[model samples]
Target: MNISRRALCGVALLAAVNPLGIHALASPSAPKIRVGVLKFGTVNWELDTIKHNKFDAANGIEVEVVYFAGEDATNVAMLAGDLDVIVSDWLWVSRQRSEGEDLTLAPYSTAVGAIMVKNVSPIRGIPDLVGKKIGVAGGSLDKSWLLIQGLARRDHGIDLGKEGDVVFGAPPLLSEKALSGELDAVLNFWHFCARLEANGFRRLIGADDAAKALGASGPVSALGYVFREKWADENPDAAMSFVKASAQAKKLLDESDAEWRRLAPVVRAEGGELEVLRDRYREGIPKRPLAEEERDAAKLYEILAELGGEKLVGEARQMAPGTFWAALKT
Candidate 1:
């Protein structure tokens, strides 16, 4: 095994600048936070901004991104002590904590999808959806699905799931079906819905609106940066620094149109689709305080639990203690 001077120097420089201070490595300069994200997730947009602008370094932390194929894979990696943080919903974080695993969420995107119909479709609202062929992405336990069901039941006096000829499929597949007129309406994830909108799909009701209709304060966070609470406590500086960097990245993205154009290829969107994505991403940013968000989540938890049952919410009927990781001050 031969090591060249350049390679050796590179390794030395890495060790010198990194101060992760836990599990993977020890360094004195600045702590490194290993962040696991979906390979093509929207979170990458913000992370890309952070890395491109050196926000992590400016905030006194170094970010190491590890891409995963799926959310479940990242969850396994987190529990196996292979990652420091990952983007996930508070629902999963609450479930993990309830089961004694001690996972916590830092508010990220509040973005959620909508029930969309082709512009010419007769379906205009929840009541109109009765007996219509509706496609749902992300299966039965998807929070948006359950929230819509709850809203339908509350406002329209119908088990919307039962009333509609519901079909469950992946987001992309459903989006295509809706676009081709194979489905009357479709409930898909945010990005998929954005694309559909760009292609002339009309939203019947957004998930955020459903949450509000069902008594949530406003749009609650659908996803966040999740971490092991014990690990976060041990590395408070790193944890807080990463949070600050994420906020800075989001702020930059919120204000810069040029940045959106720069990230076009990364998102695989352009023209109207790109514009829609940028707008949706900005809409999804968590603007409310932690307390307000947590409170809204608590309210939504009850409705979701009623509609989705033990499968969606696990044994815990509540949102679980420490689900929001609020103690780590931003």
Candidate 2:
């Protein structure tokens, strides 16, 4: 996840058109907006739906969906101006803003993650995770991991990083390790956690549950759509259009299981995997953006800042004002 500038430059040099045959670059005659995305994330499904349904064309813009392997690649692309927008955590957006980068975030999904264990395991709750081998998806600095650390410290007076043998790996590998008994529990991203649940794993605690224990008023979404302030200022209509289109896609996802079935091929999900993803998507789809004044948002920020330390959000303990794009409120 530590992407040096030179490495990013190399990636840019080697970047190619999307292999899926979706347009890699927008037409010059139209407003061209390049969006960086991960092939397996929820934004991938939403963007694919938009493209397949001609939503961008209907909105008077040409969107080139650029695929990235991870957040590092996407961050590099966006900073290099190869991408106009990206779906990322609000914490990243806040960090960028702290460094004087003009970034704004809008809600994507409020789906928080979960701690999953085998159904037969003796681990019944967060307290039981003490002295356990827990597999973490993503690095030690991951927001969810940080939040869980905070939860552990507050709820049971235990420092999870000190008490538990935490192994960091990719979601798939974490799932594999947890299922095979190599790890006692796995703190995974929502999608993989859903898959584990579908395979009969039981959730010890979800993100929302942890957040509430740490004093959040309601659910908090870690992911959102991030864009540069200058770009939004210059292309106001395009920005609004993109948000509207994404909102439409979210609505479709929220309203119809049939839509999930239709999108399975596009999302590259199959059989029971498709059903699992559908359920996860339904659980994650945000009803609306989190309000800046809400207690939930404030408490969530506090937890992240306190637990994540300087590694996550720079030296700032508070989220930069205007980090949330209020234009989307309309």
Candidate 3:
């Protein structure tokens, strides 16, 4: 009573159309999640995962990544509804909210953005910056600048918020200007700070340090996990999933130095590297998001208020719209 060859072929054909069997073998891939990130520097970990498509397989997430060289470029894209998410300084979100841009802060992303000066220059500290020119990326709106500005006011009483006290110039020119001695120093993110330090620039206190000096009890240079508010409202589950996956990724990076070391070249490829750049990243990365709202963040809101961003104060009080943090439970 052997089965015929024709009968076996017929059974194979049926299996191809059988939903139960196909589903058991492999479920359909998870929907792709598009993420927008800064094009260069300390954002290496997220970029590496996106570049290698690592998260797609591990977390059942497909990421469509878009890169921008500066905050303005990213802000424009966010305004145009071109991005599903953005990872950047929370300061940008504060400014956007102040200006009435519709976006939601997902969670804390990173805890670092710094500024450095040349080692041999006369600019020994923030006090020396009194008459020296400085380069800043986003004029007065840049969060890094605002944090440092708040610091100068609090610590040194120089008040960089004023005109001609500290010059606002593009970031790219800072390195060249610092190297050639054309400029005294500059405010930059951590990765560039490493470069400036390696090229004989001295550490003039990072944004995190400045925040602490100004009496911030916890993390100061907080990076916000952000996206369009309308998008999050429409796709609550997807947004929740994104935040969950991002929290997982941040945890993985935090717990493993070997994994971080493996990612340095990827950072270098995305942008130029200076000595101990990876170290700078590791030093800055935090293990987890705050379980509750942070006082320091409220302090940041106050800083924005001083900067004439009253609307940011209102939005910071309601940073996370959805109660999705329950998903990040260990």
Residue-level lDDT of model 3, residues 46-144, one tens digit each, is 556433524332333456777778766776777787877766655556556556776656555444556677666666667777766777655666666
Best by lDDT: 1
Top-TM-score structure, candidate number: 1
When 2 and 3 are scored with TM-score, the better candidate is 2
In model 1, how large is the Cα lDDT of residue 183? 89
Once model 1 is optimally superposed onto the true structure by TM-score, how far is the C-alpha of residue 320 displaced, in angstroms?
0.9
Ranking by lDDT: 1, 2, 3
Write down the worst ten-residue block by lDDT for model 3. 321-330
On a 0 to 1 TM-score scale, where does candidate 2 land against the true structure?
0.87
lDDT by residue (tens digit), candidate 2, 1-330: 122335333322332223232233232365778999987676888898777755565555667898887889999888888889998877788788889899988778878778899899999877788889999887898777777788778867889898898889988888988888899999998888878887879888887787777776656667888999898878877777677667667776777778888887776777777888787887777664457323466567767887778877789888877678867665
- Cα-lDDT of candidate 1: 0.84
For 1-330, candidate 1 gives per-residue lDDT tens digits of: 222335433443443366342223323366778999989988888889887766666555679999999989999999898999998888888988999898998999999989998888777778999989999998988999888888888888999778889999978888888888888999999999999999998889989999998788777889989998898778766777678778878887899999999999999999999999999999999898888889999988878888888988888999897999977434
